[model samples]
Target: MKITTIETFVLGERQLLVRIGTDVGLAGWGDATLEHRPGTVAAAIREMSGHLIGTDPLPVTRHWQRLARGGFYRGGPVLGSAVAGLDIALWDLRGRFYGAPIHELLGGPCRDRVRLYTHALSARPEHTGEPDRARALVAAGYTLVKAAISGPVGFLDSPRQTARFVRDLEALREAVGDEADFGIDLHGRVSPHHARRLADAVAHTGPAFLEEPLRPEHSRLIGQLTATTSIPIATGERLYSREEFLPVLQAGIAIAQPDLAHAGGITEVFRIATLAESFDVQVAPHCPLGPVALAACVQVDLAVPNFYAQEHVIDLRSADSRDLRLLTGPEVLVPVAGHLDRPTGPGLGIEIDEDAVRAAHRDDLLVPRGTPRWSHPDGGFAEW
Candidate 1:
């Protein structure tokens, strides 16, 4: 059957969902982590729909190439994210048509379950040091957790700020002990000077990885930092395409973290993972968005041999939460002991509750515009 129409829904303030309708009454859903830019991505999808309106959904690769390389200027957040949503929907449609899951269509699963590492809500370094939250996560059966350390260090912060950052990590290490794995996210807020000092201080804590120690543009600096520290360097949430990831990967960065929603959906992320595998680098697919995006990540995680632990928000633990059951049908991403089992249902394996999604949609609910900024005590601009 041919694709007939493409529809989009922006719901829950920042979530963007795409539904592709086909002539055979089979529709597929996909999520794009556009947040505030949902409308922009949606417009891009609408513009590109002309190329896919009458095409067969079975040939995913051809469709991906036609929409991606078909354009003279290709591969950025807007185009990649827009294509990502469509690509996922197409894959889901293909799986449903064949009565199999996406992973089976990709080459079947290599493992029964996928490991996940979720983020804790504590933002301040001091707050993360408390054992109560760590204990709560552990008791909930999570073996891996990540906390944001060093909120917004200036380019040239005093030794006291650095000391506090180190002390915070030290406290968290002491609280969690060796029983569980903990990671620190610099959030690209640290300057190279401070990043070096911070990395040197926390190297002893044995963090699972140092996430986005510097901004995505600082590739050369990231290489320098990677060389200076024993801690594994993880990045790529800001990166949207394979071309953008080449430099970071070639620099010998240990971990590649590509968000499923922004990094060209399952089609390109699978390719990105394979490319990372070729370079002998591990992958930890960045997923801080909704349930649909998480479900998409698990499909890729199941097939990729060089897969690393998945990143999730700790708040998803509450079964009664709206985000927990955002999608309809079976719980595609079931977390157990800090890991998620591969879904056994057809298509993406989880169905979207159209009614719930439509009801959640609100015009006032929109992604915050502009870059969110944070600052140090010295009044210098910091990353957010």
Candidate 2:
């Protein structure tokens, strides 16, 4: 069947939904939500659709090639995210057409369930505010949790700031004890020197991994950081293509954190994961977006043999969880005991609530990303 139409829906400040309609009564949905750049990604998707409309939806791989490399000027967050949205929607449509799940189309299931790690932001700076939140999630059947290291961090951080990050992680570890595995997200905020020092400070805590220890551009520095610390160094939520990831993979980092939305969707990330696998590294797709994006990541998680854990926004555990549930229609696969059972489907198992999607657009509920931009005491710009 050929793609007859491509549509985009902006649900207030929530999700940027992309829907692909086929001539044969099959429709697939995906979220193209790029933090702080939804409109731009949407426009990119519209531009890409010039090629997508009237094309066979079955060749997910070929479509990815055309959308990603077909453009003379290509490959950045905007185009990557745009191509990612269509790739997922096309996979969804292809799966429905085949009456199988997207993972089955890629390969078969490698594991019965995909394990997950949720966000653990602390209420207080020095402590993991409600340290019990980790316990509650563990009680709900999660075995792993991850949170950003708390306290303000600049190009260089002070002794007290470093200590506070340790304290915050310590609080979570102490609160959950051995009941769950904890991870530290450096979030590319610290200098390489500080990252190495922080790694030493928390080496005693047994964090499962230190995420984005340095920014994506610091591949060589990351190698140095990896050498200095025993903790597993994870990065690459920003690197878009296989070429960008080669150096870091060679650096011998343990985990690759490619975002489903930002890193070229299921098609490219599957390739990225396969590359990581050859290096004996594990894949933990970065997904803090909505259901369609998470669903796409889940499919890859099941198909890849080296998938370690899935990262989810803690909001999935919040009052907004209902809204997420609504957006997903009946394709919602909530994590059980911190593990999501392999999603079986015709395509990535997301069915768009077209009405809700349109209502959100009409209501203009597109959630603006309000991520903070930090600053030093003397007014030097700080990392967000």
Query: lDDT of model 2 at residue 340?
Result: 77
- Overall local distance difference test of candidate 2: 0.80
Runs in model 1 lying further than 4 Å from the true structure = 123-130, 365-371, 376-380
TM-score for all models, in order of appearance: 0.94, 0.94
Per model, how many backbone clashes are there?
A: 0, 12
Compared with the true structure, model 1 gives a TM-score of: 0.94
* Residue-level lDDT tens digits of model 2 in 1-384: 789999987754436778999888889987777776667788899888988888888888888989999989998888888888888888888889999999998889999998988876777654533568887877888888887765457666777777777777777788778868888787787889888888898898888889888876677778888888898988888888888888999988999998878777888999999999999999999987777788898999999999999987735553246646545444256666777777776788666667776666733333365578777788887775
* Model 2 CA deviation exceeding 4 Å by range: 12-14, 126-130, 314-320, 327-332, 362-370
Error of 1 at 297 (Å): 0.2
lDDT of 1 by residue, 107-191 (tens): 9998999988776556444444445677677777777778886455668667787777777777767767798878888887778
By summed lDDT, the worst window of 10 consecutive residues in model 1 runs over: 121-130
